[model samples]
Target: MNKLGRKLSLSISLAVIVIFSISILLTQYFLPKYYLHKTKERLEQVSNEIKKMDKTTFIHSKETIENKYGITIVYEPINSNVDELNEVVFSQLYKKRITLNKFWITEETLQKLAEGKKVNKIYDQGKLKSSFFASFMQRDDMLVLVGNSIVHFSDTAKIVNEFNLYMLLFSIILIIALVWILSKKITTPLKELKDVSKDISELKFETVHIKTNDEIE
Candidate 1:
């Protein structure tokens, strides 16, 4: 490759690297947050749907709702004594037994529930990373809890980076070929001009017929 081809290839390779680096960083930082936000929104929607249903309808459809949404639904009485709240009533669909304390239901969260506000919690400690949505059912006088496992995007980021690596390799090869073609086209005209200058210096007056259509012509 000549000087022009080398320069063009380097510039394009640098631009491609910069672009892919920014894309990878953005995916690493923002993609998981966006997924979490969407998951929270979905949980809030489910909570609202439960709030709209009557007690009998909600109780009868508990299993169906749990299966449909892939979430665990639990309810606890709105007791003033938090310590007395040892166990929360779990839906029949829930296989594992869980205590009220496991849900991270604190005094502040209870207060928020009493004031007609939904509380959201993220459990990131155990092997199962999950998000919980808690809301108060005024009609039934019950605190409704909905829990769903959170999907981590680390694996997704890894897959994307791997795909980008393959694409970068392919792009490098394509850019090299493209740079070679372009440099040949540009230098062909310059080479012809150089030959014409040499001939003129030797007093060989031949008609220079360079038809490059650009200023190089």
Candidate 2:
């Protein structure tokens, strides 16, 4: 096979590969982005319902929680010790928790909770899994906080998440570059082949001496 033929074949194969790689990359990029946007929209709709009541409300609600909020639960209680107290505590806490949009609390926020004050809250981007509630009320000589881990955020957790996102984006760019270069190399030969074929057909040569297809499979 002549040098020209080999080059043409290489270009054809490269074109094929580049096209395939581009298709794959586009699929990878768009599907996740589309679904993520959809999820964000859906979550945002529900996210606004979270409510954090004042400590006094948290306390007073406990007395009437069962009558006000009790319903059949999917999970049964393992132990039935002190049923009324448990129901009251669970209902008061769960009602507040169910309305929370994001899982996070600051020391200032906790302080307010302890003092029976109200504060606006935002979700902690660092922690993906916060959906807990807490109540702090002064009793005699002590300040008590009752909260579940579901609504807290940590600084280190946010940093780690940001790092992972950067790594994912870097990996995506690397893959795209690899695909692009491979596409260019593979297409170069195919372009040559197209030119050569055109010349042959246009001329209608009785005997062509070109050995160009040597590299073409």
Candidate 3:
């Protein structure tokens, strides 16, 4: 009875752990990817709006666009260095970098921009990260680099993973308790049957204690 109870408990625990662990793994993997894809689409839409704007409108509505989307737009002239941006634009860039300090603009990024392409990028700064859709199009003689910040799905993914871990732990503990109780109930009849068989082997009939509705019990 003791051995059978232990086996049942172990089996139940493994089954519960396997099922919930897979669910947790899937949630951890797919959900963030979905969020990231959605964010990319939104940022690309913002980039399109910027592309259609005239220089005067873009300059005037820059702050509004940034505020509306929770993003910073960095405009760089083809000839000027990144550090040589105008004071107002530099200030906006400085403010945005307060949280995320690092960004990259590779050859591919520049080449794509030269071809009037809007490229999507993922930027990381230590623990902080965000997505951006970048485009370098004709704005007077200058090539304007406009980027929009998208939602940081990685941060949300971390929070979700932590919550699921705690829930998984709690559920496992609960299932173990339930399995133990059920194993005890199931073993009761078997214990009674064993004792009754012992008495009959010695040529004595004894009242059995099993109360199950089955004929064998």
C-alpha lDDT score of every prediction, in listed order: 0.73, 0.43, 0.66
Tell me the alpha-carbon RMSD of every candidate: 4.6, 13.5, 5.9
RMSD of 3: 5.9
lDDT of 3: 0.66
Which parts of model 2 are misplaced by more than 4 Å? Answer: 1-147, 154-157, 201-217
Stretches of candidate 1 off by over 4 Å are 45-108, 129-140, 200-217
- Candidate number that wins on lDDT, 1 or 2: 1
Candidate 3 Cα misplacement greater than 4 A, ranges: 1-19, 80-92, 98-101, 104-108, 126-142, 146-159, 172-217
Order the numbered candidates by lDDT, best leading.
1, 3, 2
Q: State which candidate has the highest TM-score.
A: 1
Q: What is the TM-score of each candidate against the true structure?
A: 0.68, 0.27, 0.54
Higher-TM-score candidate among 1 and 3? 1
Candidate 1: C-alpha lDDT: 0.73
Which 10 consecutive positions of candidate 2 have the poorest summed lDDT?
70-79
Q: How many backbone clashes does every candidate have?
A: 0, 11, 0
